[model samples]
Target: MAAIWIAQETVDAAQGGDRQALESVLAGAQDQVHALARRILVDVEDAREATQEILILVLTKLSTFRGESAFSTWVYQIAVRYLVNAKKLRARDPGLTFEMFAADLENGLVADPPKAPDQDLLLNELRTSCTMAMLLCLTLDLRLAYVLGDIFELDHSEAATILEVTPAAFRKRLSRARSAVHAFTAQNCGLVNQSAPCSCPRRLPAAMASGRITLNDYPNSGEGADSFQAVKRRIGSVVDALKSYELFSAVPDHRCPDDIRHQLTEILSPNI
Candidate 1:
């Protein structure tokens, strides 16, 4: 599972000022890097900026990346370092906690999606945004640990190296983060527990009323990302019954966002 790292020769060539090689390396990793940043940062805009920063850093520090670890792990260290310093993490959602909503779910409330065709589309955006937003609720270090250990399925050793901690320490921290997510999601998220009160259809109006999403911006008949099928593909289909890493896997990569892809292309195009 851990074998999917950049080749040593590729790393060496890039570090040796092989422009095409550097571009190749950056291109290969940019989407995953962007996805990680999106989860680590508070919002999409911040994630986009952080991703661009990571792109530049990857190129600038290519020579410094010793091949002592997985190239992806090395890249994460740089991404997290930049996010820690550059990202002004948004304030935690005052009303956001799986525990708080858990009780409501336990009370046996069933809020189904409205009969409208766009209801499915809205729910997709809402749940995906909600999941990603939950990651931001954590402190920087814990957040990074959760993303690596649970979402990305990295081994304890690899994650520890990325965060520069002992394996034991990484395991302990990851346990805490994982437990928190599990407890909340298991109780409050419909996808995790069938008895949960919150369903995408149920939460759609509230999410839209607050301007978290727009119908015009997302339509069932739209094209590209706008088409209902397209939207579902980008934000994986909801199972309403996720287990373990299944929930995180359902969340799409951040670079899947077109704007971020455009930004990455603009930044890496000239240099790479």
Candidate 2:
């Protein structure tokens, strides 16, 4: 949900073929674009590729910006369009229903397992992965609505503009998405319902056993990421329907790879 505002003058300079200005524009847009791509697309690699493609689209279409909206909104419009239509990107597994996920949660909970040296990091990874997979259970449109309206906390009008829908329509879609997620999590997630069968610690063992989580590559791991205690405290402060969403929002934004800017620089150098 972090955003860097691109000044209109900077946008104009970029449009006028200023390479540094262009890089600045794209760099400002990168984190947000990647964040949207990461949530919309399931795979990490797929999100990266899609983020690059969306930025290229933004670049190619730069001249068309007539300044009718904020540059960030314009960027989001392009990103939402590309992501919604990028069918070739990996689709969620056909069998990954709430029922299946519930069963998975129930199957491998270590009530009192020995702790690892990096328990917090591993638990963060598991929580992020599990919640992301939960989003995939919703259909693409619903998922977009939930992520934009709920997790990112974008205004309904703004989110509607990005999705090219009316505010009321967006709200309806978001309501559906929220209901589905809320229902599932209320019954299953320990953060939402303390008596629930699954907690991050309980599921860590299963996640590792299934190779869903590995120490060798911790995509969601980061320094000072929200700890389980912090997440629980936040959850306790929110209403029942919103606790699951609070948990989702608590996951750290996946950092965009540094090399993306370097790659963009290389791609734009010839034109410069």
Candidate 3:
């Protein structure tokens, strides 16, 4: 039924200004539109906006589609264009904070990776790990590509079409995006800079929370070595937390799944 509605006959009639046919196409494509919006925008409100815009554009530009690709692909193509533009616009807005994004991230939820929808414990654990800030830094194009490729596990060629890029180009972008995401995760997880000043233990967060000493004090060379030790202890606490959580374990090796990591990133992201 869905395939029939989005087929060329329906699209042709809809483009001919047939309102009922247009509605049929929309009804049929609604799920696809929402899924694409959510994956690309990672925010419910943004997803809805993107979906609305995509539908409208599809309706308005139906005649321009020259049958170069599958109807679904064309629809996704339009959605991807809108999403890319939206991300750029949002990034420019100084008032839009990570908190807003995190809150909105829950919109247009899709099936989890590994098809574990019944695993509520895993989902809850992953939700807690969702970090919004890190997610935001993962450029708009990267997010689209990552979702289509990694989470949805689409092949390179298909993902490239969704991104409107050549397969090789898509692969390159995916590689870079994956690397950047890893670095972002490592920085937030405090694993890459094991010895760096910021790479301290998690216990120090308690000190930070208490405000016993200013963070600036640790950087001052003239400040007594005691202040430095306090910094070290704090750094240690962070490291210990990472170790305890086994955040650095190889993929599929740690108790915490990627879903959980994604969740943590979302939660801590707003604070950043």
Candidate 4:
């Protein structure tokens, strides 16, 4: 029921304050909520905190859900409202300009290849680090639009409903977002162009040193430098077929971390 839980009956039950149904709904929806928040928010820590708050907010507001939209769609609306506040509280963190990114390219950033094939941990780190940095580069509305349209692949009408915007407005926002990201990545990211000078591995040291990453804070997922290259590849190459957004999608999803997920589960479990 949680996985494909669009049945109006279950939604009605949950809305009616049925504890079990509410628990089931939240549990099933966790991954999606976590993923969206993580992408929109600044870091895992912020994302995790905001995710827990999002769940609680949804729990309290679920009763207000009018059922005019799909339950999942309604959930995203709540998620957006909660995250909007969270983003404002974040310290001013506009990322490098495209000119600076291009400078990194001209300066010839290089990726250090992972030693082994099973270094899934480093691959995870690389993907997370790069994607999070990229997301932080975007303005709030654009970031939200990009996540819903490009990463999550929400259609304009459905995404607009969740955003409370008309399809035309949503498309315009997404278009602006796509243009900004495409401009940067087409020249910078290896996922979009293998020949690009920067690679996740090469940037990893700087990120960790600068405290942009702190695997030490979380449960050891074996993402440390010597843990083998989780996504082991020796060289980058060009890919002509895929668009930049599709290339951006190649980065894996590192949703809200485990500790936060469990904390939420514990709080919501009794309700269930």
Candidate 5:
């Protein structure tokens, strides 16, 4: 009976019509799918939709999953296809432009913080900065390579697999992406408010303003709360400084905020 049960599972998967098996496969790769989709869609609701489409494509195409590359690669390829199509579909509006993208990025960079702290303003800024269409249009290989490479700290080789390219090719793509981002920043520097930066009193986190959290009291407080708070204040100070920095003047690389700091550091590190 045990032998028969094992055979049944294998046969069901081979048939490729087993929805449960397909769902199981997708469930196992859920994080990977969401990450890729988020890189493409950016917006949470739209990313969710794109992810569903990618999963459906994977299920429909599972029969073609001959033991070629790993199943994850196959799924990523499918995801790339769906994401490209979705982008093309959205592009038909005819109103999209670099200006629109810059506006989106600048505005998104400081929008509403998540209702919760673990998913708060900083994380929102990080996501918006990474997903801004200005950055996405930087290449044809999808936006995964750039985001994963710098923002998420994924290695070049790992990024290459997600991008479906060799590490060397991935490096070239990253270079081009960085160049495009620089051009975008140069072109939009005039628009960033230099007079009042986003460090508005309202947006400043409590820890940054008062410095009273030194003695975080809780039954099971994490070991480094004080250190983390210090970093938060430092980041807050940077944001506050942007309000007064002349956007039109040459932006010193050292002054760039965390969102695009890596790119700025690469270009300005030598000058500094």
Candidate 6:
């Protein structure tokens, strides 16, 4: 997916104290910021909260933006700084390890899982959740490197700028993250390795039983979506290592919740 860029004119107007321009700037940034937060933070609620706080920081710091970078880059710099530190505030335990995740994938899988009314949707939910859990296996710095450099497809220099690290340092971090993810998925994920034991269907029952596949709260649930089979067919030809990263790119882009604008407006009401 292409990165969303806010027009410099709009940013300028917002910085000049135009309320409508400010709203436009924030609206343009909301989804990308929320998506970054979602990728970095394991919990949906924590991501949402972090997005709000990050946007607020952007608004407050708008005057400090000197336009040395693209507006999106500047916003992302703020976001990464906040999210890297905010990991500690996450409600979910941040102790997930690759060994633990691999074991979880192998545990409680049913030979022939019963069908759900919306099996495709449920499976998609499980697949997205499982992939996200895999990300949690990485440490905060490595996870951010993978999310920005690999999953979001940001350029190494740009991603490094966002993280305030030297390009070589960022590359090293991304390399480590990629190796860990590739090693684990190549051994355990059916999508990457057809010989692997853990397929989405076989794991759906365990996911449902563990309350990790709730239908109503599915982050990627939408109409006219393809099943995992269709998704597999689309990316089946890619090399294994790239395919593991593509799994993340293939998941639908997550939108900021509907009430976010309203909530932002409420929070900024006194100033606006």
Candidate 1: clashing pairs of residues: 113-201, 222-227
Error of 3 at 109 (Å): 26
Question: lDDT of candidate 1?
Answer: 0.65
**What is the TM-score of each predicted model, taking all chains together?**
0.76, 0.93, 0.52, 0.76, 0.50, 0.93
Worst 10 residues of 5 by lDDT: 248-257
Clash count (model 2, backbone only) = 0
lDDT string for model 1 (1-272, tens) is 12236777888887776766765676667777877876776465666667777878877777787777778888888987887777244342233455544453344333654555566566666666666766755656788899888888888888899888999989988888877777777666656665667755666666676677777563211222343334334334444333535656656554434554456445554554
Candidate 2 collision pairs: none
Error of 3 at 23 (Å): 1.7
Where model 2 places Cα greater than 4 Å from the true spot, the runs are: 90-95
Whole-model lDDT values for every prediction:
0.65, 0.83, 0.50, 0.65, 0.45, 0.82
- Across residues 1-272, which tens digit of lDDT does each residue of candidate 4 receive? 12224567776787776766776676667768877876776465667777788888777777787878778888888889887766554554456556765574344233564343333454455554564567667778888998898888876798899888899989999988888887787678765566667765665555455655455442223323432232223213334434565455545555445565456545764553
Q: Using lDDT as the measure, which candidate wins?
A: 2
lDDT of 5 by residue, 1-272 (tens): 00001233542473444544533454455556665555455444566666666665655565676646555556666877676667653563234455566554344233444333453333233222322444446444625565656544455775678677888988987776655555554444323333322322223243223431223221112311233233334334543223112221111111111223233223432332
User: Of the candidates numbered 3 and 6, which has the greater TM-score value?
Assistant: 6
- Which residue runs does candidate 3 get wrong by more than 4 Å? 1-5, 91-134, 182-272
Q: Per-residue lDDT for 148-258 in model 2, tens only? A: 998788888989998999999999999999999999999999888888989888888888889998875678646336786777788989898879878788777876788
- RMSD of candidates 1 onward, in order: 5.4, 1.9, 16.6, 4.9, 15.8, 2.0
Off by over 4 Å in 6: 87-91, 215-217, 221-224, 269-272
TM-score of 4: 0.76
Worst 10 residues of 1 by lDDT: 219-228
Stronger candidate by TM-score (2 vs 3): 2
Candidate 2 lDDT at 146 equals 93
